[model samples]
Target chain A: MVFTTIVNCVRARGPDEFWRKRRIFKLAAHYIGRRRNCYTVAIKIVHRALVYATKGRQLRKQDITELRNARIIAGCEQHGLNFNDLREGLLRCNIMLNRKTLADLAAWEPYSFKALTDIAKQKTKEDGFGSVKDLQAPVGVITRGMSK
Target chain B: MSVLKRVQQWATFARIWHVYDATWQNPFQSAELLKKYLMGIHKPIYHPMNDCGDHVIVINSLDIALPGNEWAKRVYFHHTGYPGGATWTLAWELHRKDPTMILKKAVYNSMDGNLQRRYTMERLHIFPDGNVPPELMGNVSNQIRQIRPMPKRLDHYTKEEVEKFPKIIDYPKDYILR
Candidate 1:
C-alpha cells in the first residue's frame, strides 16, 4: 500500500520535478523525501538501485549487431547494391547468413564476404532480381583485428 | 583432502579458472564457493582489512549448463524512464541470444568489489565462445589437480524477510505464497 501511495504521490508531482532521469521519477522522490523508517522501504530501494547498475549489460550485443549491420550496408552500397535490393534479393536467394557472422567475415576477410556477395550478385542477375555489381574489391581491403 | 587443504585448493582453482565448468555459468548456483574462492577466505590469508585474491578466466561461456526452470521465469528489467520507463527481457531469451554474457554478468555481480576486487577480477576470464585465455592457461601448469566440482548452493531467506517485499501490508496473510 505504501509503495502504491508513494508512486501515486510522485506521479502527482508537476512537470517541473526533475524525475531522476527515469520514467517513475517520483518513486524515488517520495520515499527519499520522507526518511521512511520502514525496513521494507529500505530493501525495496536498494533492489531498484541494483537493477539500474546492471541495465547496460543486456544492451552490449544489440550494439555489436548494429555495428555489423552498418558494415554490411556500407559494403552493399559500395558494390552498387542498394539496401532494399540487398535485403529483398538476399532473402529469396539461397544465402544463409546472419548479420554478426557475415560482418565478422566481411571485416576479417572482405574477400570472403565479397566472394559470397559475388555469388549473391550472380544469383540476382540470373534471376533478374537486381543490377549486377562488381565483385572486384580493392586488394588489402581488410582492417586490423578483423581476421574472424 | 583436509578441509584446510581443500580450502587452499579452491582458492587457487578459482583464480585459475575464470569460467569454471561445473557452476561458472550460473555463479549464483555456486555463489558460496565463488565468494570463498575470490575472497581468499578459504586460505589463512583471510584478513578482513587486507585484500589477497586471485584472477580467473572463463571459457565455453555459451555452452554453460543450467539446472532448473529458472531460465524461463526469470526476467531482467531496466528502465531509462523517458517515455517507456521500463524494458523487460527473459533470461532464456538472454541466454539464447548471448549465453555467455548472462553468466559473466551473474558472476561479476555476485562478487564483492572490495579493496581486493580488482585483484580478484584479474583472475576471472569470461569467453563468449569456449576459447581459453592462452596466457592464463600457462599459469595452470599443474595437472596434478583435478577440476574440482563446485559445491551446490542456493539463496535462503527467512520467511520473515519475504514479508517485507511489499512496502506495506496490513495483514500478515498477504505474504503467504499464493
Candidate 2:
C-alpha cells in the first residue's frame, strides 16, 4: 500500500477500516439497494435501525402490559366485578398475583379465575368496598375476618 | 390436518352468541362492554386481523337510560349532500323515532372506523324489546352482566320485604305536611 503523500498515508485507516465497515455492512445486509452495499450509507441506516430496535424493545413490553391489562379487565367484567375492586380485594387478602399470571388464569384456567373472583367478591363484601354494598357475600366461601 | 387437530381448530375459532339486557342500562357504557364482545377482544385468541368476533344480541334497548340531561342535550346530526340539507335530532326524539337507534349508534361509534368496522357491526343484533325472534334467541348461550344494577321501583318491592326494612327516623309529631 504505497501512498503518494504523507497526508494520504495518515488518512488511510488500513485493515482496521475494513473490519469496522464490515460490522455495519453485516448489520445492514438485509437492507436493499446502495444502502446495503455502500459503507457510508449502511452506517447511517444501521444507526437509525438500531435506534428503532432499541425503542421497539420498550414498546414491546408496554404493548404486552396493555394486552395483559385488557385481558384482566375483560375477565373482571365477565364476573360483574370491576378491575379495581378485584385488585384491591386480592391485595387485601394477601394474594399477590401479577397481571400476566392473572391474565393467563383468566384466559386458560377460567374455572380457577371464577374461584378467584368469588373470593374477591367475598373479600369486598367483608370490607364493604365499592359497588359490593348490595352484593351478597359469595356462598360457601367464608373468608378471613368473617366471624367478627 | 388430522381429525383431532381439525376439531381443536374449530373449537378454538367457533363464534359464540352473547345476550345483553339493556334494561335500565346506560347506552354509552353498554356500548363499550358490547364492543369488546363484538370485536372478540375479550378472547385470548383475539387479533386485529383475525375473524374471531362474537355475535351480541342486545335486548330491551328501549329501556336504556341516559344520564342527567343527555336525552335532551345529545343531538344526532344528518346531512344529505345538498344545499340546506342538514338537520339535528335530539336523543329522545331519535329514540322515539327508532327505539334501537341510540344503542346501535353507540356500539357503532365505540368501535374504530376501519374497513373492518362495517363487517364487525353486522354481527350486532339489537332488539327494541325483549321479544327477540326465536331463531336469534336460540343462538344465545351467554348473558353479559349489566353495568349498573336495575333501580328497584317502590312498587317492585314485595309488601313484606318493604315492611321488614327498618325505619330510620319517625316523623316529628308537629311536622307539617308539605
Candidate 3:
C-alpha cells in the first residue's frame, strides 16, 4: 500500500524556523562557546536568561520607588519642609499631588512648587502643626490667600 | 473619571515617604502604622497583589514604649531546630542587645506571611536615633505624628528659659535642702 518516494527527516526545516531559533540563540551569543553555538545548550541558557529578565522587571519597580523617594526627600530639604508636613498640608488643601509630580515641580518648575509649598505652610499653620512653624514663608508674589 | 484621565493617573506612580517618631510610641500602634504604609492601605490605589507600598522611616526606635510592664513580661523565643536549642529572650533584653529589633520584629509579625513580605520590609528603614544615614536622608518626605510627647531633656532648657519656667511649689526657707 505504501508506494511513495523516500522522505528525508534529517533535512533542514526552513529559513523561517532556523532564523526564529537563531534569534534567541543570538541573544545568547555572548554566552560561553557551547552555550552560544550548541542549540541544546543555547535553549537552556536562553530560558534561564528569560527568567532573569522577568525578575529584572520586579527589581526595576523597586528601583523606581527608591529613586522617587530620593527625589522627594531632596525636594523637601530644599524647600525646608518635612515630607509629611508637605503632604498633610497639601491634603488639607484638597490638593492630592503625588510625590513624583511634586519632585518634578521642585526640579523644573520652581515657581509652581513654591506656590504649593506656601499653600502647605499655610495649612500646617492652621492645623497647629509645630514642625512647620519655623519654616520661612516663600518670598515674593503670594498666590493663595491665608484662609482655610 | 474618564478613561484617559484614569490611565494618566495610573501612569504616575508616586511613592510616598512616611516618617515615624518611635519615641514613647506603643509597639503595637507603631506596628499598625507601619503595616498601613507597607501595604499601601492609606492610598486610594491600593491592591493586595500590587507592590504599591510607601517607604517608612522610623526614628528613635530605642525609645519605643511597651505598655504596662511589657518590657519585662513579654518574651521573644527562637529555636535552632535541634534538641535543647530553644532560646527565650525578654523584650527589654532584646532591645538592649539591638535597639531596632523590637520594632522590627513587631512590624515583621504584623505583615502578611507571604513571599512579598520581604520586599515590603526592604522599604522600612529604622534608625536608633534621629540621625539617619546621609544616603537615606533624601528619601524622607513626611513624618507621622508621634503617639506621645517626648519627655523634655534637661539640656534642652537654657538658664534663662529655666528661670522663666513656672514654679509648681514655693518651698519654705526652713525646709531641709536635699
Candidate 4:
C-alpha cells in the first residue's frame, strides 16, 4: 500500500533570479563600499539613481524656459520696449513668431529684431493701446494694417 | 539652424536683476509691475506654468503710495483654521510693521493660485530703503522706470536752480516766512 509516495516542497529561486540581481550589481560596480559588492544594496541604490535620471528630464524643460525669457528680456531692453509691449504689438499685427525664434533674433540678429519691433509698434499704435506712445515706426516699411 | 546649434542655444540663460522703484506709485500698480516680472509675462517665452521670471529688486518700499484712502481702507485678513482664530490688520498698520508687506501681498494676490506662485515670489527682493547691498548691486543690468516720476527733494536743488524757479504768488513784505 505504501510502495510509492510523492512529496511537494518549496524550492529556491533559479539562476535567472541571481542573474537579474547580478546585472544591477554590475552596473553599480563603481559604487563604494558594500553597495558595489552587495547585490541587495546595489539593486536599491541603482533603482533610486534611475529615478533621478527620469526627473532630470523635467528639470531640463524649466531651465529652457528661463533661458528663453532671459534672451527676450535682453532684446526688449535693446529695443526700448518691455516684453509685454512687444508681444502685444506682434499679436495685433498677426505675427506668430515663437519664443525660441524670437530669442534667436534678439541675440544674434539686431536688424530683424528691430524690424519686428517696428511692426509691432505700428500695429499696437493702430490698435489704440495708449501706453506705447513712445514707439516710433521705422520709415519705409509697410505693415499688414498699412497695406489696406 | 542645425539641430546641434539649436540645442546649444537652448542651454544658455542669463540671470539679470531688474530694479523697480515704489516711491509715489500706487501699491497695486507696483504690484502689477512686479507681477509682470514675477510671472515672466514680460517675456515672449512666458507661460503660466513655467518659472521663467527674472530677479526683481524693489527699493523705496517704505515710500509706497496708495491711491484714494486705501492706506486706511485696505485690510489684510488671516486665519489659523480654528475657532476665533481670524485676525485682521489695516494696510497702513501692516506697512508700518513691515514696509515691504503691502507690495509683497499685492504681488501675491495678483498671481494665479498655483504651485509656481511660491517659487515666483522667491525671485522678488524688497528693500525698505534705497541702499542695496554691494554684492546684489553688481547683478543689476537695467532699471525699470517708475509709474510716477519721483518728486525732487528741496535739498537736491542748487542755489542757481532755486532762483530760476517761477514764483507761484508774491508774499507780503511784512509777513515773516518760517
Give the Å shift of residue B124 in candidate 2. 2.1
| lDDT of every predicted structure (CA atoms) | 0.56, 0.89, 0.79, 0.80
Is model 3 an incorrect, acceptable, medium or high docking prediction? incorrect
Q: After best superposition, candidate 3 residue B150: deviation in angstroms?
A: 2.4
**DockQ numbers for every candidate?**
0.01, 0.25, 0.02, 0.06
lDDT of 4 by residue, A1-148 (tens): 4525343221223357766776787789889999999887888999998898899899988877777877787678666777788888887777889888888887677679889887777776677674677667567767777789
Candidate 4 lDDT tens digits, B91-121: 9899999999988888999888888888889
How would the candidate models be sorted by TM-score, starting from the highest?
2, 4, 3, 1
Off by over 4 Å in 3: A1-148, B1-12
lDDT of 2 by residue, B1-178 (tens): 9999899789879999999999999999999999999998887556578798999999999999999999999999999989999999999999999999999999999998999999999999999998999999999899998999988899999999998999998789999989
Error of 2 at A147 (Å): 8.0
Better of 3 and 4 by lDDT: 4
Model 2, position A75: C-alpha lDDT score:
82
TM-score of each: 0.35, 0.64, 0.51, 0.59
Give the share of true interchain contacts found in each model: 0.00, 0.21, 0.00, 0.07
Worst lDDT 10-window in candidate 3 chain A: A139-148
Residue runs of model 2 more than 4 Å from their true location after superposition = A1-19, A38-44, A142-148, B1-13, B19-27, B43-51, B58-105, B113-118, B126-137, B143-178
Candidate 4 structure, TM-score to reference? 0.59
